[model samples]
Target: MRQQSSPHLSRGFSSYGCALALAALVALAACSKKEAAAPAPRPVVASIVHPDGQALQAGSLPGEVQARYSTPLSFRVGGKIIERRVRLGDTVKNGEIVALLDPADAQKNAASAQAQLDAAQHNLVYAQQQLERDKAQAKENLIAPAQLEQTTNAYASALAQRDQAQQQAALAKNQLQYTTLVAGHAGVITAEQADTGQNVSAGQAVYNLAWSGDVDVLCDVPESALAAFAVGQNASVTLAALPGRKFSARVRELSPAADQQSRTWRARLTLAQPGPDVRLGMTADVTPAVPLATAAAQHGLFTLPATALFHEGRQPAVWVVRAADNTLELRRVTVTRYDERTIVVSEGLKDGESVVLQGVHTVSAGEKVRAIAPLHPEDFAS
Candidate 1:
């Protein structure tokens, strides 16, 4: 009687255990699905959009101190260069002789012209005396009228020959003076093109002269920055050789066309009162004096880090954070230009708005994010 057991009751207990295990598995799967559906908020490095006017005004371009008038000094007549009075870097005064040519040939031509002129004068005097004699003989009827007329004609021819010889003599004298090259203005010799004993043709360059009076800062400005520079604009110039000093300057000239090789326009800025220490060829930096607020208002530009820019298809876009819910929205922006470390946005942004500075590729539209300042802030300094 003790050994007897109910097999139906044991089977009922086994079925109850299986039902409990299936319910526990279902609950755990639901929890896993919930976690996969909602993700944690991502942290992003970001920066506030700011007006680019200050950045544009802070731009400094490399330049060189130069002369306002730089010209090549050359000879007016062809000859051999016998002597060069001034060397490179020598200061010359107005009307000072800079070089000399061999005067042997010029002197000979001048002397020959003078001798011809003297002979013509003697002939002229003889013709005048003969004309007086012919007039007296014609009045007394002691000589034929035709002979007197011929003598008068001879006098006129002599006078014409004398006038021709006088002009030739004057031209020969000028050529003799041209053998010496004189400086037209007070300036410094910057270059020497023809050396001593070198045979040069007429109007050949001998030395390059930089006029002494006004100094200029010459710079090659890229096409993008050309808009900031205009004629009569004020600027500040600093030289590398003369540190701790800044010279006031004004924009004097700008090239109408861009250079073919560098695609930069040449700008000439005249210094107001350059010191003696400002030498030619010294490296300089030129900063325009345009107001930051004015420049920003005029251009309507904003600046952002290069890492913040993203491309959708062929168009450039940026990620802007929505202030209401800290969500991201992909915005298409119009880029005015691109620098090495930054992008200049002309539209599609506003001041004080936070934009993603990094990790732009990993974020999605409408995703929740926490905006944080960039760890390496120096990257966006430009």
Candidate 2:
């Protein structure tokens, strides 16, 4: 026999079942509604347009300090170096002897030349006296004409010998003088290649003398920047040896052709009143003056963060926000210059226009965006 349930209990069970079904239907509808809703506006960082007017960019390059005029001193005659009077970095005056060679051989040669000249002179004198007697006898017809003619020829030969001997003696004297190497100009000794007891050949470098008056900073520039640098342009130089000091230099020379090895044009800058601190061969840093981009930028030009630049079919473009609806529009821009952190725009949008500086690639054309204040550039300074 089966037991039957009460009427109230059955009614309660049916009501519970209906409530659970209704709850399930409500939750499903709520989930479907949430999934159908539109997404929030895309957030982007942007900056207001500000021209680079009057702002100059500086380009720096490594350089070396050197004398405008340098001389390599060498001996005119080869000999063993007996004495070296000057050392490296020694100050020398004009006509000062810097080195001496072994003068034994030179002195002997000079003496030998002198003896030959004396003998030649005596022979010439004797021949002249004989010629005079011969001429007198010939005039009086006391001797044969052939004999007189022979005496005349002898006198001419002696004269020629005397002249040759004189030239040899002069050369010997010059050789003697050349044994002592002297400085032709007053300057600081930059290098010494020979020492005492060292035998150097003629025309071999013995010392390098650098004039201390004018100084130049030498640097190389690439072909792309050759047009920006001229002979008269001004620049600032900093030396590695002298910290906390800056020197002004004017461009003195710019090579017209590029170097075969470096493919760079050499530039020399003349420093203004360089002090003693500016030593030869010192390393230097040259900061050349950069001209303004264009005269049209006097009014205004746009400069954006490098991240804002995007390529569109080989052309650089930027995402500009439309003022009316805050929608992004891809605008083609002409880039004047580009650096590591910034891009200078010469022609593009108008002044006061806002462009996306960050997250440029994430957004698309005609997409609604929420503009946010861009971070100050200084915040990322490192």
lDDT (Cα atoms) of all candidates against the true structure: 0.88, 0.84
**TM-score for model 1?**
0.65
**Candidate 1 local lDDT, 231-294, one digit each (tens):** 9999999998888998999999999987876657899999999978778999998987874355
- The local distance difference test score of model 2 is 0.84
TM-score against truth, every candidate: 0.65, 0.61
Q: Tell me the spans in candidate 2 whose CA falls farther than 4 Å from its real position.
A: 1-58, 291-382
lDDT string, candidate 2, 140-177, tens digits: 99999999999999999999999999999999999999
Supply candidate 1's per-residue lDDT for 254: 99
Q: Worst lDDT window (10 residues) for model 1?
A: 291-300
Shift of residue 271 alpha carbon in model 2, Å:
1.9
